[model samples]
Target: MEERKKFTFSRRGFIRTSALAGGGILLGVNFLNACKESAQPPVNIANLNFKEFNAFIKIAENGYVTIFSPNPEIGQGVKTSMPMLIAEELDVPWEHVTVEQAGLDTENFTRQVAGGSQSIRHGWEPLRQTGAIAKQMLIQAAAARWEVEPYTCTASNGVITNQAGKQLGYGDVVNDAALLPVPENAVLKDPKDFKIIGKDAINVDVHKIVTGQPLYGLDYTAPGMKYASVLRPPAFGQTLKSFDASEAKKVGGVIDVLKFGDKVAVIANNTWAAMKGKHKLTAQWNDTTLESTEDHDAKLNAILNGSKFEVRREDGNVNSAFSEADSVIERTYESPFLPHNCMEPMNFYANVTAERIHLVGPIQTPAGTAKRIAHVLERDEKEIDLEMTRMGGGFGRRLYGDFAEEAALISNGAKLPIKVVFSREDDMAAGTYRPAIKYRIKAALKDGKVTAYHLKEAAINSNMYGLIPHFFPAGAIKNYKVETGNYQSNITTGAWRAPYTNFLAFAEQSFFDEIAKELAIDPVKLRMDLLDNVNDGEDERIEYSAARMKETIKLAAEKGNWGKAAENVYQGFAAYYSHNTHVAEVVDITLQNGFPKVEKVTVAVDCGIVVNPTGAINQVEGGVIDGIGHAMYGNFAFDNGKPKATNFDAYRLIRMNETPKVETYFVENNLSPTGLGEPGLPPAGGALANAITAATGKRMLTQPFIEHFNTDTREVRG
Candidate 1:
């Protein structure tokens, strides 16, 4: 049915309902197609009010629409995507919608965190129904004016058009739409008629980002805001024994040296002044908390060497296969701790008062900030207002509340607004790293078929312990066992890219390469057989799209020229399903004068429905290179409790000349949209390892493949 609403004129101006706040307000919108199947009704976009405050809004006389998105937009491009959903359902021109960075208003906010790539997928339906229901009320208002049936009126591009072609702009219909009862069930547009869903839209903030406009937390300078620098423990679990800030406070711009129980913060008028004050002082550290750069290397090696933990996966007996095997192969791989090192280092601004805390910054999870700040500040949850801003890059590093703690403490002590900035070195030295892992995969095959496989992985499982409670079975392996072991490394580890998949693919796909060698079969063909050949249509749940897995592998193999090769050039392939997206990739590498030089890569994915095909492809391309960076050279060695690689000068990243040409293809599917962000990362690591193994007949279990090349056999140069 065509839907419309009318506007009401008043001295305060006309009150008109809008389809703006990301598919209109979901507060008064819900499913019109509810059966016993639905749980709640849609919100009343026209007349409904925010549960807490009298914040109900209507379209202004000028036809502007405003909505507050609670989630932070870090460079992963949420501002544009979230806004797109709202504009699409509201039937408003995309240009007409204005998104307000939602302040922490729990009563009116949605999930408010942009992690696990759940932003778009989670908001799709609620936003749609909200827009549809709002459009309905607008149509009813126009129907009253035309003296005709409401079903004969349809709304498009903010205009209500009747069957007889009589049309009225939404400004003329909002007040009327507001008066009508919110429809019980509003019809939604089907996919065939969608004008915007799958189309490409330029990033809404591209101009601001390019112009170096103040967008990130670093640029957020409030009036009278003092810059602060905190001396956090070099490693986690270490408490501050004592500190001397007398020398620090003597710096020209240094205001005060505020002590906050565990750490001392030097505050000043400018960031440079704060940094100067910090370097001018010396502090004492507890003996137990202190370790020289070389002290812990032996202990770290011991922990990796002697492992014990729970079995994350198990299938047929590994002992039985080893007992009856004609040949057995075992290889161990190790990865060093890595820092996220997002372009914009960690920074946050917080103003803490006796009654409330107003914290704003480029944070990934505002809701998390609200809870943690409320508890730490000993204030009511309502008293804390968190504002999520555009993030430079989350990559899961921004989830930690350590920076929030610093801001809150500094603000509380100084009785003024405080913004804490972590210098590139501090962000690196004040640890949170990708946990170093030691993986040992053992395979037993006879008659060219794998009978038993055992993968023993050791790392601090602290980061992904929440998300992937159980790993390995998440992958499609028939006879697989994953033994997990944790070592108490002072270097705190957290979710980076695909988290466990980083190590899992390192071990899983590396084992596959060895199994392929033992069986003398193509690696791509072997994985395809594992997914499709062993898969049933419905009976057994593999937790992955086996069919899609097969298709992606087949597609990438063809594009990568699987059956052909050039002198010194070899191809490696890997497939993984994570964050609900199935991805397969092939890396082309060659033993160039000996070191593995990546030439090009071809990747294919089945990510349900591509929300924005270009974005999806770009994300896949970026993720693959990111994974490649980790595989080829991404690492920060931990010596003792401190980082050996503190800067890009020491820690390496893949440069343009080293970056291969990435071609990504999306597998056609009729399924709903899943996430496109993290799924593309896992396969690249394994693909590079497999490609390297193919180029040089060695089971490369370790990371960076650098140590393997710098082995006793010979050294490889770039």
Candidate 2:
């Protein structure tokens, strides 16, 4: 057999060789050397004058076009939708374009992240410009050969035709085009003329996924790699004091026991050996002053009842409005801390040497991980190469780079390339949970209308990021005041899916439903009246689109047949705006043997513009199911500073049989797309809770509703 040729590029960051099999002209753009943070401002791809834009396009001699997508794909379908933008502006047929996931090269790609649902919002213009620039160069090359003015030539479906009727395929002129100067200006196609965007497109890697191909971080491998499992402190706020690893070293295939900080790692030749070795090790922890759940709850409630707190948002005089009210409604809603439970668990691969560190895994923040690794290993940011792999599930758990950093430290300590894997128990018990919160809301109504509202929220760790001030209904109410109290803890907390809005929407929207019933008014109409009174011009203050919210609510109600459910079915409505996307959900639920069961859900979304309709619908459907699962039975409690549910055996998850039918629809518009990942999630829990109240005369104030109903007996529990 002959030796295979290598793939090489020039020092200028452009690849100009036919080294690739099946001859083609490839164009690759390099990214600027910037800071290692994913939150960068959007780039305008219409102007090619920018010094850095790292994207790739290849015009194969066989007429096939290949584009490299530069964002990490965590099942959000950016790999498919992003390429459609490029192919559309290139004036190429969608069927002839191929998309591939690019590696993490900060010098060639910026903000390669998977969280925040920002990939489509930011990549839209830059990727399109990459294709348009390539198309311009090809047209110029063809015009130079035909000896005609470039303006007289028009390109369509990979072919350029002149006024004289002479045609040239892009593959024929790509060689000459590679030598031409990069154009400073490239005109974009009109939205009406778009052939690929806003249309349904299949995921590029669907075939590999269904055929049992290895695409996730857990399935990654490298030469002479060792597997390791770490034994972290059994509980938070504890430190390792001593360890006995003699028995672990005696285990078959066990290589060594490495100690780093408060954790000890068992390294072996394979995963099973590493796990078995880890189980045999015995470690003692110190300062195990365990805190109880009851203590934390008491502290949070005390803060909520006290007057000392930070003022997040305050409007008109709430005290005077409450004093003048005809009636007052008050309730306190609470949620427990929840874990991410990402399907594949947490695993990372790191190869460290004297020169540099190489890391790869399914992390949401690649740039942040690089920065963390550089800081930990005392190496330059450029010395670390971070490659992103498809994640099994993110849900904001992968946003932290602790796993990657730990892997790098272990690799350096062990003097070998190491793959650190977390067992299901380890991952579930690890903290970084969604902060548990308590909300005490009071609404004063006069003349059958809400006049004043006050919300006092108590939370563990940090409070919501501008949730109390910027969330909707703030401007809708005349007299509104928001206050928050916080109690710090050793347990780590961070973003989980929709973050604070996940439970906040459930609490606030459910309260609105209660108010409508007490006032003897239709719940949908009550919200609509509030929206009518809301001034859309104050968008800067409220930070939400009132028009879009109203549209989605109206559309969802119409499609779900709100207030006109069939026999044994009752409908509940809720709408919320978050992550720059507006979403409304109507749930149809029925009681079976005194237990509420969700039958169906109809969702209306206004994410401005839908890039891939199929992908957007999938996101909405999945979010609805996820929301239902959490509302029905998603929770984890702490006892003696340790999680009670260490794995799925104790903790529960929604199964296929329990999933409700979800129907999704989008509002048509020409605005730039926002995000679909987290917005669809916030309102779903609230709608389901409202439907439960409709089906059963009792309201389930607490989440995971499992405490009130028995699954086997289908009876209300005392």
Candidate 3:
């Protein structure tokens, strides 16, 4: 036999393997993989072997592979798509691969976050390398058995074949492969050879979701766990004075009531009893500095017109360009604070004891939440164990783990295991809403060409980040300026969906259409002309790829039949670059009973490589629908520091019958993937707005277009 080299392994290496009890191999990457026996379903961890090891892939006695996806499954489809990257490189048939959601393991995984649509973008390479290394080890094991060079031996479909026609299944040699030295580097497959990636794969949890199995946070439970319904401050800028819980204590199934800072928690045997007991309580609040929507509106408007402004970005001389211009077109757009309104209400389970703390819930930031909990409880981080359940829907809501912290605190206070559940009213009324904002866009038109561009943003709490100022149309305009101002308020606000770009894209793209109309140029042509001014690599600040953006624009225009709409059919165009992805959209609408009825939306995206076409399409369609629904009807406000709407009965959402058909096309490329979850959303609103304008000669300068144009009746609301 060839001299075999003895090697020692370190945790930092890309691949780690160990022999299983029943003559199999357990392999893990820095990202980790699944390790489950064949006797149980991949998700059923009750009988999991190698529990202490943070491994991902496990080749059992049979030729089966299980991959544990480390990121949270916030309906982004990473539970299915992340494994495809590994199975493709492993040369295993997709049918033989089983995927399971992995828990938080700080030792093996990095960037386990699910926000920013980065799960796939970040896992694209390392996940593939993991499988490639495993496949290389298996091939080497087979080569050593057959006394042939590893290069001559080939692995395919869970089997290795040597040059002399000797063959062995991965399961037959997995024990032997476990002893082989892991390769420092393994060759990756070419894009042309991809089998599972770029192909359609159904969601791994579809069966569980459709059958209403226990997968979401709402379905989680623990032995002897009591339910909690918390009553927070009734309104913004309010503090709790006192509560009379005597009547609440008398309610059936009510156990006990505990008062925490600024809130009261009702503990009961079940959620219904907890809620009932909470409703029976009488609480007094001290409301100072009570604010209203009108106040916010005035404050934002004042900031826009005020001289005090922080210039985010400036190029050339905006004053000189504006002063010398022939005409200046300025328009202001406004948006209201909105709630996430996830399908499942917020819920978390916590068990705090003298020895350790156990937490389970749907949280986007697991490690950060755990750390925060440790800080709050004055406990060591090692004593806390958190388990993430599948979320019904996040949309940036679960990014804040206030609910989890509440569960932990309530459990610690009650001295028992507790599950904190929020009612729909509680979910909406006390949500960390999307900050209300207003944008004032101005353009200096000189001799039929745009000379300068300026944008001013006034928001509720904070302004847009530095990256927004460097997005599209930055390098294209010679004299461009971006300014922002904010009014700090007591109401809490944070990231919602795509954050700044969600509304910014609408304002900027709609302004572009207005510019096209003023110049009497085709909307598509105007955008193309502006893009022609942007030179690639000339400015490092420009994050958008002009070449890629132009391709998407051209594709959307062609597919949408931009200028060839039939009579009575109105078309609108908008394009945006955000989340490192370029997207172009065209909305088509027709007058139905004198009201614009959205017919279809054509979208073209350049997100580099498409991981799973089915999941990608689903994400695109969901984003477009979400964008249209929110832009048309989503609205929230506060009256005297109290939320105006608390439930869907008062709030409005898009009806299924009113949803438009979304057609998506991708510009295929072999480059690394970018974001997908939020990119498709930003442009849909602007496209719909421009299309409505084309159908009816009205400019939409505010969100919840229903406020300006009534969808129920044929007349304008104003």
Which candidate number would show the highest lDDT if scored against the true structure?
3
Candidate 2 Cα outliers beyond 4 Å, as residue runs: 1-25, 29-53, 107-110, 464-468
Task: Work out the TM-score per prediction.
Answer: 0.88, 0.93, 0.95
Please give the distance, in angstroms, between residue 31's alpha carbon in candidate 2 and its true position after superposition.
7.8
> With candidate 1 superimposed using the best TM-score fit, by how many Å does residue 380's alpha carbon deviate from the native?
1.4
lDDT of 1 by residue, 1-718 (tens): 3343332211111123435343322223211111122222224444533333212223543545654454577666566666565567667776776665545556444456777876666766655655665667678888999999998988888888998998987777665565566655556666656666678877777778799998788988889999998877665546777778788888999998887876889899999999999887677666455443244444445654675556755666778778998898888777767788888899999999877788888777777777887787788887887766788877888878689778998999899999999999998888567777776668777777776777665665442562242333333445666666665645577877777776677667777877777788878777776665454445343557667777878888888888687777888888887877778888898765567888888998887666566667778898998999888787676545667777888888888888888988888764667777788888888888888877776756567777677645445523
For candidate 2, lDDT tens digit of each residue in 1-718?
A: 2232222222343323333344556666432222233323223323322213255677887678988766778888888888888788788888898887666765545567887887778766656665676788889999999999999999999999999999999888877786676676577776776778888899888988899798889999999899999999988878999999999999999999999999999999999999999999999989756766787789888998898788989999999999999999998988889999988889999999988788889988888889888888888887887778888888999998888888999999999999999999989888579988888889999999999989888888755454547778878898999988888887888899988889999989899998998889998988888877678776567878778889999899999999899988988888998888889999998887888788999999999878899999999899889988898889888887789999898998888888899999999887788888888888888898888888776677888887779889888665
Candidate 3: tens digits of C-alpha lDDT, residues 62-112: 889988767889998888988999899898999898887767654334466
| lDDT scores in order | 0.70, 0.82, 0.86
Give the clashing pairs for model 2.
31-108
RMSD of each: 5.6, 6.5, 4.6
Q: What is the full ranking by TM-score, best candidate first? A: 3, 2, 1
Off by over 4 Å in 3: 1-11, 32-55, 107-109, 463-467
Worst 10 residues of 2 by lDDT: 32-41
**Backbone clashes counted, model 1:** 30
